[model samples]
Target: MTLQLDAYMHEKKAWIDSQLPLFLQETSIPGKLKESMLYSLMAGGKRIRPILLFAALNTLGESEDKGLSTAIALEMVHTYSLIHDDLPAMDNDDLRRGKPTNHKMFGEATAILAGDGLLTFAFQIIASDPALDGDIKSRLVALLASAAGPEGMVGGQEDDLEAEEKVLTLEQLMSVHRRKTGRLVGFPLEAAAVIARATEQQTHSLTGYADHLGLAFQIGDDILDIIGNEEELGKPVGSDLNNHKNTYVSLLELEGAKKKMADHVDRAVVFLRKSGFENSLLAQIAAFILNRTF
Candidate 1:
């Protein structure tokens, strides 16, 4: 399953690489700025969000060519988030994916510019794609903006910073993670529905599925923070503790967090079943999320 997922991910990775530059290269930025932005944007991660978007589109019977714009755009937003999160004002990390972080290599100012460029370019990538109808493109643009904006991913990040030294209840912790991380995951599922012209019912089911996947992914990340090593994770472990940000596993205790993740995975499977996602690869993807150490 890992082999299959890895192979599939490679295909999407190639697609993203070829198209991502088109978005950033046209921004009229200096050559070096574009280089730093491209460097971090091209750096390897799971590519999970873009892959999930493509997988959802595939099951909806959309062609990859038609989905390419969204696939790349979502990846840009994700990469932008990581570049900013690794900044000194945020995670203050020096390493990511076993390389110097964006700020470390580019200086804080350039790194900030690169991230801003990526974020703005993500919308442009989606807006300019000829694959989607004007109405659908508009909808997706609004969807992404809201999901990544103050009400969603950014809001969650702020909450995390404020929760420092505060003992978050399980619900509070869930709130922080669901937004900071979960909405970004959910956006792809919703995007697939929009692109495929799915019915309201199907969209609803897919959304629930995405929500479960998103939250479960966060729980697994929490567990990794406790058990994972920095070399394996490509970042420092226990930084969450050092930063005093609450996580699902942190609040629940590791045993309880494991149990909660089990529940989440099960619920996600149920939603996928209802949505008729019979793809074995997605099933294996579920297991990967549950089992990943970094």
Candidate 2:
């Protein structure tokens, strides 16, 4: 199953990488801005969000290609977030994807603009996608906006920053992660249902799977921060500790954190099974998130 997943990820990542450049090439943005945007966008990572979008579409007996526009926009939004997250004002990271962060390479101002460009262009991509129905495109655009907006990922980030100065209880930490990470992660799955016009029951089931999966993914991230290798992580490990952040590991310890992560994955898998959509691929993807070391 691991080997199969590796193959699947390799193929999907290659497709994402290949198409991303085409989107950049078509953009009319001026020289250095375009370069800066491309630099971070091309920075290598797991490409998990876009893959989730594809996987969700696939689980609905729909072609993954049907989700390509949404997938591309989703990756753009994710990359934009990463670029902003690494800024001097945010997490203040020095490296990402094994290279200097966007700010380091392109100057802080340019990096900020690059992130803005990606965020705006993502909406444009969704709005302009000719393949999807107009109603579908409109709904997707709204969903993506809400997921990336101040009330969601950005708001979670604010909470995370606030938490750095204080001790966050377990529940507070969970709320922070659900907003900061879970909502964006779940958006792909929800968008899949929207595109597929899935039944209300099916949508509800996938939403449950997505909710659990998102939380599990963040728990896995918190666990990895304590035990991960810097080389594999592409950024320094232990940043969470250095920042005095309260993570699942801090709250529950390593063994307890792992168990909690496992519990979420179990719940996610149960929901996936209940979704009844030939979800072998989606189940593997969920496992991949929990088991991922990097």
Candidate 3:
């Protein structure tokens, strides 16, 4: 199953990698800004969010290509977030995907502008896509905006920076995790649901699935930070410890965190089953997230 999933993931990732450059090519913005955007954008990651979007659309019997524009937009938003997250003002990371972070390659100023360019360009892609209805496009724009805006990923990040050295309770930590990771993970699935005009029950189930899956994914990340190899992680390990961040592993201990992650994966699988769609691919994705090396 791992082999098959790997094959499928590689195929989807290749497709996304091939298409991402074309989107940057459409930008009329002159100068090295485009180069900066493409630098981090093309830097390799799992491409999980866009793949989830495609898989979710497929589960609903919609053509996977129907979600392509939105998928690209989500990737842009993701890349933009990473670029900013790695800034000296933020996490101050030195490596990403085994390469120098955007700020390391480009100057800090150029990196900031590159993040800004990609972020706004995401909206343009959504607005310019001819396939979606006006109403659908509007809703999608609103959803993506809110997910990536102050109340979502950015807000979570702000809290994260402030929460350093502060011992948070489980609930407080979960709140941060939900906002930081869960919301973005849920965005593409929810968008696919909306675009497919899914049933209320179907949407609810998929939302539940995404919530659990996102939590499990984050927990897995926390676990990996303690035990994962830097080579495979493409970054240094013990970052959470070095930063004094209160992670699941810190609060729950290694065994406890693993158990919690397993529980979330189980609950996610149950929700996926409740969706009543042929979602084997999504189920596999949840499993992969829980068990991934990076």
Q: Candidate 1 lDDT (Cα, whole model)?
A: 0.84
For 39-104, candidate 1 gives per-residue lDDT tens digits of: 998777777888888878777777757777887888888888999998989989888888899988
Could you give me the TM-score of model 1 versus the true structure? Answer: 0.94
TM-score of 2: 0.97
Off by over 4 Å in 3: none
lDDT of 3 by residue, 3-105 (tens): 7778988998999999999987766876688888999989888899999898888788888887899999999999999999989998889998889999999
Against the unseen true structure, what C-alpha lDDT does each candidate score? 0.84, 0.89, 0.89
Between candidates 1 and 2, the one scoring higher on lDDT is 2
Q: Look at candidate 2 and give me any clashing residue pairs.
A: none
Q: Which regions of candidate 1 fall more than 4 Å away from where they truly are?
A: 25-27, 278-280
Weakest 10 consecutive residues, lDDT, candidate 2? 272-281
Per-residue lDDT of candidate 2, residues 37-137 (tens digit): 99998989988888888877777878888889889999999999999999988889999989999999999999999999999999999998988999999
Report the backbone clash tally of model 3.
Answer: 0
Stretches > 4 Å off in candidate 2 = 277-279
- Preferred candidate (lDDT higher): 1 or 3: 3
